[model samples]
Every structure is written in C-alpha cells, then in structure tokens.
Target chain A: MAVCPDFSIPAPFFYVNTFYDILYQSEDAKRIFGEHANFFSLIDVESRRKFQRLAERRFEPQKFELLLNTVQSPAMLFDIHLKWNRDNHCSILCIEQSQRYQQITEVLTRFTQRLGMTNYDLLRRKEELERLLANLQQSNAQNDRLVELGRIAASIAHEIRNPLTSIRGLVQLLAPNLTSSAKLSYIDIIISEINRVNSIITEFLKTAKPAPPLKEAIPVTDLFAELELLCHSESLLQGIELVILPVDPSLMIYADRLQMKQVLLNMLHNAMEAISDLPNSRTGMIQFEAERFGRYVQIRIEDNGVGMDEQTRTHLFSPFFTTKNSGTGLGLSTCYHIVELHGGTIDVESTPGHGTVFRIYLPTVDKKPELS
Target chain B: MNATHNNRFFQASLDLTDSIRMKIIQFAHILLSGDERKSWEFIEQQLVNGIHSTEIFCTYIPLAMTYIGELWIENAISVVDEHIASCVCDYLIMRYQAQYITPPDQQNCQAVVACVDGDPHELGAKLAVLLLNRHGLQTHYLGVHCPLHHFLAFISKWRPSIVALSVTQSHHLKKVQDYLEALQGLPYQPEIIVGGRLIHHLSYTSSKGAPNKQRLFFMQNLHELAGWLEQDYLPIKPE
Candidate 1:
C-alpha cells in the first residue's frame, strides 16, 4: 500500500551485532569503509572510549558524533545513529557532522576575540571613569567646604565690619587730638591698617554674597586703559612685563564696570604674586587681551609665572581655598561670582612649570544703553 | 507642550529634525559600544558648538538612554551592553556636573532635588538639578539612595522653598507618599514636585489630577519641568 523511499543514497546504513561486529554493509558503507568486517576496525582509537560511553546509556535509538576511518582517510568524523532490533542487533546510519562542528568552532573563536577587544575597551573606560569620579568627589568636597565657609563668613564679616567701623571712627576722632609728631605717625599708621582690614572684610563679604551687577555698556579699550593705569606702579615695582594687546575701541560689553575692573585688578595682583614666587632669573610677563567672538567678548589674561599644580587648580576658585600662607583666597572666588552675575563664564588653564591663562567670556554689547 | 516652549526646550546648534534623530542614533551606538572617549568628545563638540546644556543632558542623553533601554528589552543588545552604557552615561553626567559652574546663588528660592529613599536611579534628578541651577534656582542635590531620616534632617535644616523628588519605578511611589506625609508635619510646608519614570505610570495621577491636597506638581519630563519653572518660578525670581 505504501512505497518505501530509498535512504541509501543520502547516508551509509549497515547492520551490526551487539558487540559492534559488522554483519552487513550497504554499498555506500563499503565505499566509505572498504570491506571492513567489523565496525570496531573502522573506529579510531579515541572514538572507542566515546562508543563505550554511548553503550552504557539506554539501548534506544540515539545519535552521536564519533571518529571513523574511511577508505581513503585515517580518521574522519561522522554522525553515528544507532537503533537496537529485537534480535539484539544494531542498525547504524552514518552522516558527516565534523565540517559543521568546525564552522561553529570558527564562529565561536571570532566571537571570543571580539569580546576580548571590547573587554579591553571597558577596562580602559573604567580606569578613566575612576579618575573622573575621584576628581569629582574632591571637587564636591571642596564645594561643600566653601559653602560652609561662605555661610560663616557672611555673619562673621557682619560682626567684624561693625566693630571695624567703630574703631575707625574712634581713631579718626582722636587723630586731631594727637599733636605730637610721633603720636600723629602712630595714629596715621593705625588708621591705614584699619582701612586695610576693612577692605579685606569687604572682599570677604563679596565672596560670601555677591551683589547683582549694575549693568552698563562700557568700551573694552576704556577698561584696558584704566587697568594699565591702576597696575602701572605694581608692575614697575615688581619689574614684570605687562602687555595689553590693542583692542578695537568700538567693542563693548554690558557689565558692571566697577566689578569688572575689580576682577581684572584682582587677577593682576595674583599674577604679580605668582611671578614673585619664582626666582629672579626668569622674566615674568603678563599679557591681557580682549576680543569679540560670536555673541561674546572674550577677555584673556595670561601670566608667565610660577604656575599652579593640579591640586591648587582644582580648588582655585573656592571661597576659602588658598595656596598662599597669607592669602584669604576670596579674590578669585569673588571674580568668579562677578563674571557669573554678568551671565558670563571663566576658565583657567595652568601647568606646574609653565604658566597660567585665565579666559573670561561675557556677552557682547554692540551699542551702549541710554541712561535713564 | 506649546510649540514655542518645545522649541525652547530643544534649542540647540542643530535643528531637532532628522539631524537630532541621527545624533541620537549615533550617540546610542557610541554609548552601547562602550566608547567612553568618543562619547565625551561628542558631548564636548556639541557643547562647544552652542548646543544648550539642557538640550544635551535633558533631551539628547535621555533619548539615547531610552533607545539603549529599548534595544536591551528587544534583545538587540546584551545586558552587559546596557550596563556599560549606563556606566558611561553616569560618568559623563558626573563629569559635566563637576565642570559646571553654577551661576551665583542670588535667588532666594532654594530647591532641594533628591531621589526617593530607596530609588537608585539618579540621572534624572541630577539633570533636573542642573537645569534648575541653570535657570538660577539654588538647588541642593542629594544624590541616589538618600535615606528617609537623613533627607528629613537635611530638609529641616535647609528649609528649601521647593522639594523636588524623583523616582524611577512604581514600587518607589509608596515611599514617596511616605515622604509627602512626613513633609506635611514640618513647620513650613514646601511645594513638592515629583518627577522621573514613575510619574509616567498610569496610576500615579488620575484624570482629576494629583491626589494630594498639598502644593504638589507631577512633571512628566524635563520640558514640563522647564515650562513650569518658566511660568510660575522664573517670573517671580529676582535677577
């Protein structure tokens, strides 16, 4: 009723005894194994152990991969399918599976190599991330400290300013009463010292709570002229070269002129101090430049002086962070606040042995605002 | 969102047409491939080229991360790839925060941004803080896994005008409710703004709006947050 499909053309099939002794071989098997009387002779030595393990399992039909010697080769891999008959004989079918296995192994090896490449990339990124995290943690800790200091300094400055004002007033009131020359000099010195302390407190308060800028459109050249006039004596005394690159007189910025000048003067003072830190052999130079870039006016101040290390640079703008023994460290922080108040940004780059450059970017004003 | 506000939200050097979508795809690839260096370079170039920080952090980064998440869900990317992308994103955010200089805290309206007590996802909260700070709010960011007691103590000490809480999943909502209940007992009640992925859940709010009677706002995204600030907070804030 049913037609039997010929399966001999696809694979070699044979019958074997329970001992794996070949009873009959198909034409395909004969061509493959070449007149082998027993299946044991066609099996490789390494495959004998695999065959033994396979025999220990249930005697139901199963498929396995084993190395079998062919007529023209010493050993070849094939898929061995075995089914047990009621007479204790086994019918076997053989199909090649080694080429597929080799292909899979090749794919796996390539995949492993790709994985290794990305693993290396991940490791590199991990190290970079660690460094970034450490730097961030340090910066955050410093910020916390500065915030606490600002809170304390605001109240302390208030208390100190009141007393300072009374002392100055009392001393000024007593100044005329001291007629003796020696006493007059002492009074003069006391007044000036009080004024200095008052100025320091003022700067400290500015860092704690900065006043909003009184915006006005001022010419860059005018600011540059005032700066040169203000710093002429100090640069001459320190014998440091102060170069102001020429700026177009038309270029202007809407900012608080007083606060802007204060920022420049403070930075120039720091540049002078940095220059003083180095030996007399090196010629200290400070270069200032202002230019219009896009919608912003960039102010650059560079100094050839004893530059800061990364540690100092990291906390350079913190309210109370200072590298100098006598420094209050409010100068740069106040400058930072002033620039930020003007909707501007400040950036600094310093190398330990080379120098330092500070760049301040402020929105440009094309035309001056009319005064009310 | 209004078209004008949406435009403002995505204000960047490149238009958010096909270009931004392309950028998102490129960014996702860079992140999933674990190319941290390239990711930074890409971000830096964008920042340098006049792309707003909010657009990059709030829009672009979030979009890229969402794509990465979707890929992981679809089995297109391995779990390891997702983790690597998350790590890279975290590092970039931290690095950006570290480098960012918040404008002087002249605003009297102080805000406290924190994740829920048990929630570990903080990128959204961090971005919120950065955006709020950029908009001139004095924001204190209490990062991931902030315990209830410690957060309460900080809230008491700081007495912020607004408390912005973030949660990543629906499971964290109960904890957020607990936070709201505890905050109600304080001497001064601060307006609360709840945000993050949990808010997008269908049950977080009803058609009638937020369940709480207190001054609470549920923001859907950074765009909504920005719009809210522009409408209510920025108008009142003194320069």
Candidate 2:
C-alpha cells in the first residue's frame, strides 16, 4: 500500500463503495490518528459531530464531498450508498486520502503568499507614482506663475517707457530757467524718481529673463554672514536688533550667487518692512535661520511686528498686491517667482498678532547622477 | 459453441453497464473535485468529443462547486494573482465559444464592455470581452471605472448594439444609474446589461423608485450572461 506521510497528491482522489485495510501506516498517520488502529475511529469529535449531523438529515452527499476531499482527515463519510451496504451486511470501504488535502492546502498557501507579494509591490509602485505626479503638478503651477509674470513685465515696460521719456524732456526744459536753490531741489526729486523707474525696469527685466545654469555650490552660512553685516549697519541706525543665527555648518546649495543674493535681499527688505511699524514699547527683532530638510535646504526669516491678516497673506505674492502705500508689491512677488524658477518653494506663516515667518526650500543636488 | 456465445453476450452487457457507471462516476468526481481548471477542461474535452455546447453547460455542477469553494476559502487570492490562470482557462473557453462564430454570410455585430465608475474589478469585463469577441461580435472594452462623460462620448461615436457594465461594489450602482441617465439624453442609446456580485443585491421594487428604468439586465455569472446574450440579444435570421 502506498502511504503518504505528508499531503502530496496534486488532485483529490475519491472512492465509491470500497474500503481497504491498512497494512502499514506512516509516522504522520500515527501522529494524526494516534492509537486508533481503525481509521474510522480516528476521527475527532468535531468531525464525528458534523458527520452525524449530515447523516441525520436527508443530506445531498455530493454537496459535502468537495469539502471532504479538500481537508486532511482520518475520517469516513457515510452516505445513502454506505447505509444501504450496511443494511445488506456488506463490509464498508475506507481509504487514506489526507495527502490530497495537504497538497491542495500547500498550493493555496503558496498562491496567497504570491498574491500578497504582488499587492505590496503594486502599492509601493503606486506611492512612487503619486509622488512623481505631485512633483509634476507643482512644476506646472510654477510654469503658470512664470508665464503670468512675463505678461506683467511686458505690460509694465510698455506703460512706463513713454512717461519716462516725456518726464526726461520736461525736466531738461525746466532746468534752463529755474533759480539755483529751487532748480537744485526740483532736479534732485526728478532724478530720484527717474532712478526709481529705472530700478523698477531693471528688476522687471531680471525676473523676466531665464536663469543661467548653476555652475558652483554656494555655502548658505557664508551668504547669511555677509547679509548680517549689511542688516547690522541698517538696524543699528534704525534702532532695531537684526539677530542672525549661525546655521549648521557644511550646508550648501547649487545656485547662482548673484541671483540667490538678490532673493535674500528681497526677503530681508520685506522682513525689515514688516517690523518697521512695531509699537515703541515692544522691541523689534528680526531673526534669520537655516536648516537642512530631506532633499532640500530650508531658510527662514522671522520678525516680531504687526503681522498681516489671512486676506493679506493669501494675496501676499500676487503682483501689485501691497499693504504699504509707497511700496510697489513686486518685491516679494519677484522673490517668489525667482525662487520658483530655480526649482524651490517659498511659504509664509503668520498670525494677526504674531509676526510673519517666510520659509524657503531649495532642492538638493542628487548624490548620484540621475539615469535618464 | 452455445456456451462461448453466451459468455460473449454476458461480457458485452457488463462492458456496457460499466461504461455508463464510469460516465456517472466521472461526472460526480468532477463536481466533487471543485477545481475550476479541471472542471473546465472536462467540459472542453466533452465539447471536442462532439458534445453539444449547450448540453455540456446545462448542468450547473461545476459552477455550483465553484460557489462552494469560494464560500469555504477565507481571504481568497486577488485578481492579479489569478490573471494568468484566468487567461489560460479563458483562452480554452474562447476557442470552444469560437465554434458559434457567425459565418461569412451572417451580419456583423458590435458591442461594448466596461466596468462602472468606482468598480475597479475588471475580471468580469475581461471575460465579457473574450466571450463577445469569440461570438464574432466586435467588442470595445473600456477597461475600468471610466468617467460618465467619456462613456457617453464613446457610445455616441461607436453606436454599439449592446453595452455590458460590470460592477463589483454595490455602492457604484448610484454612479452607474447616473451614467445611464446621461445616456438617455444621447442621440443613440445602447441596451445596458449589468452583472457581478452587486447586481445580486439590487432589490426589486415598483418602477416609481426604480432608477435607470430603461436598460437593466441582471446576470448571475459569465456562463448565464453568455446564454442570455446569445438567446435574447443576438439578432437571428429566419430559417
């Protein structure tokens, strides 16, 4: 007799109206059946109870045959055929079939494991795809902003050039006839306004132009040190403390030095403006800090001042949206567009009573060259 | 000579009796085995041996066993794991189904198969495509959870004779109804057939609250669906 200790039959095998006596039993049978020499008696109470319940009812024997064939057992299933055979005094037949059950279970277990691995792989791939999609979306939004800025710059240039030419002509005409003191004062105002218009045009041109590729790594700490010296001179004259916190050393970013400096200057100017209207009783303090974030470097400029409400903050980076009467709102908006063009993001956090904090994140160079 | 003749007659009778018994045993065994692959193979072999397709599928023994297996096994494997197995079996079934292909003299037919919005399960939809294609119907399969507008546009363009919508989740019934409403206003509206586990859950009520009133046919399984499509929907010529 062929006896399989472990379930190894690839398919279920069934016997109808036949019973065989066991000549030899494997260790697995001994372990599973345990002390019961007769295979029919080896069935556990639960199996016997199910068998009994099935026998009591006018059960369709075929219905339970599939379940029987798929489970490991040392049990006998009695149906109408067997009942008739017993009534006729014919010997009942029992066969060893647990190997088939074990085989089916093993296949099912392997199938489930394979399914689980596939799901995990798919989930991981989906997450990676979502992240890439988010990055693409952000890049698209930045492109839209750049296009808007380009239109604004073109219109501003067209509008201001004619007025500037007319003003220059009028100033020259008035210069020849005025008294010396009056002439000097008038000329000074005209010259200053002319310079202001020229500076606006220069800034507009810088924003509209495509950025040159970054050629060298610039250390952020060194840049901030130089900015501190400039802020210190102005702060001392204005009676405000420009606190410069030295960031962690070895922090570097890939960017053009001149462009980065321009961005920082704009941020500093905004910070200074925010703190200018602080109550006399409270000391105005502007803080500069930097830190490394995952795949990006972050820089923050914080100031204690009369902060803006939600409405002002929402349109803070919009062109020509400003709180100051004398200010051209392009300062911060230009800073926003410039930072975005360099593949960086800027965010502002503020409460009505608490001061504003401008946080900027710039992407880090990949450790290895990206495979195309 | 008489004894020899008697022995031969007795032997022939026994052989004939055993043959019939073997057939019954094999039928029960296939049902009892409940392995979908084996049962499908048996059915295909029978068909190849000149058994009528309808007769081979008339008995629900295999499908019933499949239902039982589904119920007994907890946490059954996902569709992706079964895709390979399904594809192999479906290929075989498709081959048999191809026998019913419309001859050159018959008119061409077109159909659309899709999964309703939020129902990402496309196994049923895939089966529908195979069956429809095998029957010589040009089937356009819009894979899964297509937006209603896209479905409407495709319908407007293709003007298929029938549209089969499969829904695995019951919650998608609302979206499917909305899609049907959108189709009602269109210039061309195809007959919509619904199937899957969710269709079984839909309660029968008066037409007053019945959504998607125009086109709704509930099918139990792929086999039943095939029969329904062939008997009810396919255009037949007068003999």
Candidate 3:
C-alpha cells in the first residue's frame, strides 16, 4: 500500500503453480493480477520467450532479470522469479522489486570520497610488509656472515703462524753461511712477503668493520659530473664509452660524497673488467644517469660488459664475497656497505652475455619541516 | 538538515586549508608507517573539539584522500600509496565506529545491513550500520559480500524492520536483484535498502522507469539517512 513515484515494488501478492493455465489462480490472485497483471506478464516480449524455455523444461522457479512494464507504470527491470506447477491442476508465481537507478549513482559519489582513504592505508601496510621481510632476510644473512667469519679466522691464524715459524728457523740457519749484507737482503725479501700477507688481512678487516658515512646535502648532478671526469681516461684506455646524461641540477641526496664516488667508480671499473675478460669483446659502454624519484634520488650505471651468472650475483653484496681473483674479494661488498650506511638501496641486474646494471637509490635530503 | 545548517557545519568542520590538507596527507603517511599513536595525536591537535567530529571526517576525506582511481590516472600518487592511504582511513573509521555508543532507550525498529556477494567494499555500508546504531536504531552489521543464504537466514530469524544491502561493483548488481527476488515471500515485510559506489550503473536501473506507486527512500550519506530516520521514525518531543 506504501508507494512512491520514482521507485516501485509491484509483486502481485499472488502465487501461481502453473504459467500455462489461468484457472489455478484463486479469486484474490485473479483480482490482483487482473488489476496489476502478473509480474511475469509485465515483462517484455524477449524475456517471456526466455522464461518459456525454463517453464518448458519444468525447471524450479528461478530469478530472471527482466524490465517490467504496465499501462499505468514505467518500464523497470526487476529480478522476477517465475515457475509453473502442473502436478495438482496448474499454477504460477511471480515477484518484482526495483529502485530508481539514480539513487545508486548518488551513493557511489559519496562512497568514493571514503574508499580513497582506505586504499591509501592498504598501500602503506604493503610497504611495511616489504620492509619487515627485508629486515628478516638481512638478519639471517648477517648471522651466516658471522659463522663464515669464525671459520675464516681459524684458518687465517694457522696460515700466518706456519709462515712465521718457517722464516724463523730458515733465518737462523742462514745466519751462519752469509755475509752481513747478504743476510740483510735475505731478511728484506722475507719481510716483503710478510707485508703482502698483512695487506690482505687489512682488506678483510676494513670490510668486516665499515665506518658510517658523514652525510651532507650533495647534488646528484655533481656526483655524475665528477664520475664522468674521473672515469674518462680509464674508459678510453679500455676502448670503452662513458655516457653521462643531464640531470636536474637541484636534485640532492643526503650521503657521503666521497663514498658515493667510490660506489660509482667501483661499478665502472667492474664493467670495464667484465668487458675485457670476454672473448672478442666489442667497445664497452658504461652509461650513468642520475634523477630524483619521489622522495629518493636514483643513480643508474649501466654497462655493456659480460655480466654475472645467477650464482655469482646472489652473493655479490655479502662481506668478502667477490668474483675477482688475486684480491681480498670485497670490493663490491665495501661499496654496498657504504651505500647502506647512507640509508640507500643498491640493486644489480645482469645477464651472462648481455650486460650489467647497478641502480642506487638514496633518500633525498629535505630541510623543510614535515607537516605530520 | 537545513541547507544553512549543513553549510555552517561543513564550513566549521572542514576548513581544509592547503597547509592542513598537506598535513593530513603527511599524517596518512605516518599512519602507514605504523605510528598509530602519533597520527591520532596529530589529528587531534589540528582538529579541535568544537568541530563536530563526524562532520570533519565526512567533509575532509575528499581533501586528505582524493579518489584513488583519479589519483592514479592523474599520476599524482602511485597505486600503492593511494591503496595504503585508503586502508589507513578504513582503520581510522573502524576505530571511530567502535566508540560509537547506542542510546539506552533503543527504537523497536531493527535494521540488518549486508553487502551483496562479490562486492567487497564495505566502508559505506559499515558507516550506515554504525550511524544507524548510534541513532538508537537496532542495527545488525553482516559484513562484506554476505552469501544469499546467510543473509536470508538472518533476515528470517531476526525479522528486522529494514534491510540495507550494499554492492560496490556493477557486475554484482545481479546479486542485488537476486536478493530482492528472495525477499518477496517473507511474512514480515521489511523495507529494503541497497547502496554502493556502482549502484547507479546497476544494469537494471538504466531503464527509463517512470514514477511508480511504491515508496523507496534513497540516501546519499549518513546525514541524509539520519534526517529521514529522525523525521519519520523517531519520536520527537516538542522543540
């Protein structure tokens, strides 16, 4: 009995067990349908054909969306469920309900104002999740590094002790056979070899305990400029090309300028070495680009050198992890440590024959007060 | 609510200057960093007590958290940042909902709110549930995309005086229609309400249906819904 003009609920308040017969409808059903018509009959021609298929199959009453219309009412779509029953004489049943579509559009405009806030929060949580995962992995890697160091410590002590003992006995034995000058020369040779060993140990210590960078606001553009000038001679000597793309002059990062130079120089040297090691290596290319991205400044150094294999790349940043022989195997590791100290992330991409790319992201320095 | 009162409330509650808007965005970032304590404190400091808290929440969301889809299109914020801000807002809204107290003398009218299946957006529906409850209506919240069976089972058992169904996706509009179909045979007839972001484009609603003789009240926000409940349903003492 309650009704409004913009929306309608015109279900016939009647039930029919058979759609094919009208006799089954009781007087009340007849009266309601006679005036309002059966909800199914109110549907358009196309839908009745569709509804007939279900009735023909004697399927259970199912809801089919149809636009219902009557002489006095406007055309509106309703999910009307209809079925025919023939077991006891014949019967049919119908129901219809709908709202003005405009109502929903208005509601959506209101809801969108709120949904945006929910979305922003979800992304923040995702970033936290990634950060937490990274921290867990770093901790595990650190524990592994400690275990490796303990083993290396024992081996190093044995290696050094054996050499000193051999030198002591040999020196005493030679003391009787040689002139004073000859003895001094022989002792000098021994000292030189010992110094070589000491240098290797020093490299290991430097990697084991890295000092934090003294951060200052330095322009990333300047870093790229200095790097190009520094590597200019090296690139030419190795038949390599150095490309430095123009970047925003004001783009600045809070990092130790000296350490950042070291990070880039090491990467450039590695690129050259990789190219030289390859058979029939063409003229090498090392491209460096610096730019500000969101709250960070990114420095990307790419090279056309023989790249690392998956196995070598995995341990590329670990302390004392290196592919080069005849060195302490800690060049790249030292670079990584310096970058981390500046609150930056380093990512490396390499393909066996294709090339290598090192992308460094450093948090940009903002002197302005953060509102929140 | 009168237009003058609405305007006054909006102006008083959301004086969202550029600086305040920027600060709100910064707070969203802080909230994302899991500094819940600091974010709430910042909000409290900026939004003083004289402003109706709900009005502030309703009016200022547009400034602080613009439509995410539009933001992504404009490249103003990454999809992830927008998503994070949205999630933080949802959490804040839920925090507000938890503190909303029901009046002692509740109305006899009971309303059941449920989202149609396949539509997971529940913020609007949840707001309706919380606001209705605060206004002394006995409201039950059946969360996002409730299966049709569960919805019907609860409706039959509780026999609520009204039912609010929310669907945020157009594809899920079918579910809304299906629900209306199922609601037809109930002995205790309840007023049915459907809401969602894509509710306007609900396929069936596109038809040019002229005014019919059945009553259905459409509400765009809690304010409008609140007005209807107070004016028609709730008892009003002489003012």
TM-scores, all models, native as reference = 0.36, 0.29, 0.33
How do all the candidates rank in terms of TM-score, highest first?
1, 3, 2
Backbone clashes in model 1, listed as residue pairs: none
Q: Write the per-residue lDDT of candidate 1 for residues B1-239, one digit (tens) a residue.
A: 12232232233323568678778878989998877678987998999989887788777888787766555433355445665777677667655655575443544448889898766567788788877777777888887788878888988887787789998755466677677667766777677888975475624324334434556787867877877777776332333
Runs of candidate 2 exceeding 4 Å displacement: A1-372, B1-41, B49-51, B54-65, B68-85, B94-109, B118-120, B130-136, B203-215, B222-227, B234-239
User: What DockQ results do all the predictions give, each relative to the true complex?
Assistant: 0.01, 0.01, 0.02
Provide the TM-score of the second chain in candidate 3. Answer: 0.69
The complex in candidate 3 yields a DockQ of 0.02
lDDT of candidates 1 onward, in order:
0.75, 0.58, 0.61
Runs off by more than 4 Å, candidate 1:
A1-372, B1-16, B103-109, B202-214, B234-239
Candidate 2 lDDT score at position B90: 38
- Superposed by TM-score, candidate 2 places the C-alpha of residue B179 at a distance from the truth, in angstroms, of 2.4
Give candidate 1's error at residue B165 in angstroms. Answer: 0.9
Native contacts kept, each candidate: 0.00, 0.00, 0.00
Error of 1 at A278 (Å): 42
Please list the Cα RMSD from the true structure of every candidate, rounded to 1 decimal place: 27.2, 27.1, 22.4
Best by lDDT: 1
